[model samples]
Target: MFSPKLLLISAIAVALVGSILAISSLYANAQNDEEKAVNSRGMGYYQTTGDVLDPAGSSGSASTGIEPMKYLRTFNYGRVSTLPNGTTLREFTMIADDRQTMEISPGVHYNVWTFNGTIPGPTIRATEGDLIRIHLINNGTHPHSMHFHGIHRAEMDGVFETINPGGQFIYEFYAEPYGLHLYHCHVQPLEEHISHGLYGVYIVDPKTPRPDADEMVMMMNGYDTDSDGENNFYTVNGVPFYYMHHPIEIEKGRLVRVYLVNILEFDQINNFHLHGNLYHLYRTGTDMEPDDYTDMVTMSQGERAILEFTYQYPGQYMFHAHKTEFAEKGWTGMFLVKE
Candidate 1:
């Protein structure tokens, strides 16, 4: 027979152990909820699929015999009109999404304001001297206008004084200078406009023949959004991680060129890295002298870089920012090589 006091002591010890276990279980559950919330808050749900085409290989020609086009004509933007090639140029409306109140990425939900409900808007490619007529259709309450970076024409500068709600404006300018460039909202409260996500990349291929490889374009930007509170958002081509476009494809031992442009409101120093290839940066800005070249290049705000490289191996490789923070926030992409 146990003493009454001993029995009471044993009961108290058991109760204490049970309480500890229950508390631990509750804590773990709470932690899991927090993790899920964090993930849900970072989703920017968007996706697309298309076959990657090698500009070099598609146009059959030998390396030495390859001849670049002398001059390319620009495609005029119109109200959903068809091009001579049967391609269509249509009017687009960009709307803003609150990053603070919406769920975006996979397993993450956060508020973000985006153009046309998408980050980075759309990629606009045109030939030299093409008239680009973009009608600024402001769907959000905020006033917005777009400025073409590196474009010297005054009418296309997207002056705030020239914009109105639901008002349309035509930017008719020739793409005289060629290289990588950008266009973004330039209305007052510029910082707020950019932070809300209204920007994209523009590429003007040279009239001459390019290398015998693949071509890719990337636009880097940063944002700050309120989600339950304010949070920082950054991305390459409007998406973080591997969400935007999967690994970019290339042929083994073929040359590749990437046109990189940064249109962030703030000055950024972006360090680009390829997983298993060495790149030669050959040109910068709209004023690319005929045959200028450099192994590595750095571009400032409103600047561009043309990077050329050859893949020696066949696999999927990551190309991303050396800035770890950007990489975590989605400033990364993949480079793929096929045997």
Candidate 2:
């Protein structure tokens, strides 16, 4: 036996619990449907439901099979030499050549131009305020130059100082702006030079280091296999569909920092999208503050940004160009998060 007031309160509580459970079931169903839709789109390209391991395929003379950690994470600090005055100098030797054949994708080969015998060249890293030098050697028939995207003196600029066949030149400059940058061949028919794969990443680290994390770099590029002036195959770090099979492994709770660049020729714009989470984006990797907190970021040629994020749940996540064609054409990958 209960008082009339007590009975009313008990009835109300039961109805509230029933309503809450009903809402939860609906929400869970919605999540499942969304996931299924995403997987449906991936159908034959990639699968997020299985274990991802090192992919089995034909990589070229230089392969970014696993991307950044090997090709990019292995930074060339240059030959560090100290002066009599105790000043440290970083020096590099860059060679320009072309018509070298490389399998940009499985069963697809192209005549790639290179710096230091590799497409996208070497990842050059230096501290802000340091003096850096590049000794350029032109070993090919065509003239080539190293144009860096940073502040430097007029002569050090690689545009007018093109090196003819068998010739050499030196570019010396002070690293500044403490951000991500790039170097490329900037001769006449600039688009052709870049499209031919004559570029690499240049990084100037801030004096005060940012928070430590698992860091990596990505350079989005494309190849015109049939000379149609449009890209037939797109890639990250010179290989097609590399990371899709060999997912980037990371700890579940640690921060991941990515330095991403878009050097795709012909295409007006490209974009990067992360699945299951959003990230803080520092546009151009220049500012200390974030430009936006987003799941996708778009860029024009030579544009880059710094992305920082952490995953909460452990599983596989996909990353790709939000534009369907690019991802299907090979600009795609995955991240395996684990405890």
Candidate 3:
């Protein structure tokens, strides 16, 4: 019933519509492929899964037996001094008088001698309402004091009036803001003391409960030395090359969360890179928000990052400073992915 001219026009329109749909489908497919590539290369958002080791014994309980948020403790044995040149220097022996070097990194195996002979001395993981008691002992000839980075009490702040060599002071105060934090000596020559390794990480996890898995804390510190050289050292839980203490051990498809704190005394920036997985940075210092998610993050001095990622591949991956130079200079750590 239709004429040849009308039929030809209708056919042409159909062909044009079909061609448009085909082009759109191809474009969508290409986009999907790009996303897959990025994720497989550990460059995008991807969920990780794995088994968590029970910190307890065969009975499956942590050995420490200390309740999750009960009590926390630490010791600070440092020294402070006023040099003849009027450069007030606060120095602390990383090595304790006992001669046992604290484990700074897990890979180093042998403990590196510290100013007080202890890597990060000791950790104080407490809750918001718990009172923190730190006994500062001046075993060295110089006088020293302990100051909490973000803590609130003025009396217990460890100012000059409250610190002295051979004199002990107990800092008693309740924890307020919760998140990754730092504690160090606030004497005149702070750069000298921190360079000598007289600082540590302090964490106050939110009162809320978290999933069952290993809890790891890392502190990135830098030192400027005149004799040897200037370098940055990544210490896990307070020991340089102590990555072994808090190695990320996981089975295929396990969720892991890492709390990274930067206690660097200088203005150097740090980039945290996870080699084989994508992570979500859920919190920063005392600020927690949904927008903090990211695969890579940067932290300046006095900042903190709380990131969670999963392991899918079965191999050993590394988490280190993306600065390249820092990683090459031994400012790196490891993460093991097991099947």
Candidate with best lDDT: 2
Higher-lDDT candidate among 1 and 2? 2
Model 3 off-target regions past 4 Å?
A: 1-116, 225-229, 232-247, 285-290
lDDT score at residue 221, model 3, on the 0-100 scale: 71
lDDT (Cα, tens digit) per residue for candidate 2, span 100-125: 88767766778888998887788898
Order of the predicted models by lDDT, top scorer first: 2, 1, 3
Candidates 1 and 3, the one with greater TM-score: 1
TM-score of each: 0.66, 0.80, 0.62
Number of the top candidate by TM-score? 2
How high is the CA lDDT of each candidate model?
A: 0.56, 0.82, 0.55
lDDT of 3 at 325: 71
- Ranking the candidates on TM-score from highest down gives 2, 1, 3
lDDT accuracy of residue 153 in candidate 3: 72
Candidate 2 residue 14 C-alpha distance from true site, Å: 87
Q: Write the per-residue lDDT of candidate 1 for residues 246-278, one digit (tens) a residue.
A: 455678887776777766545366666667766
lDDT of 3 by residue, 106-173 (tens): 22233232334444435556655445555566555455667786667788787754344556666666
lDDT score of model 2? 0.82
Give the local distance difference test score of model 1.
0.56
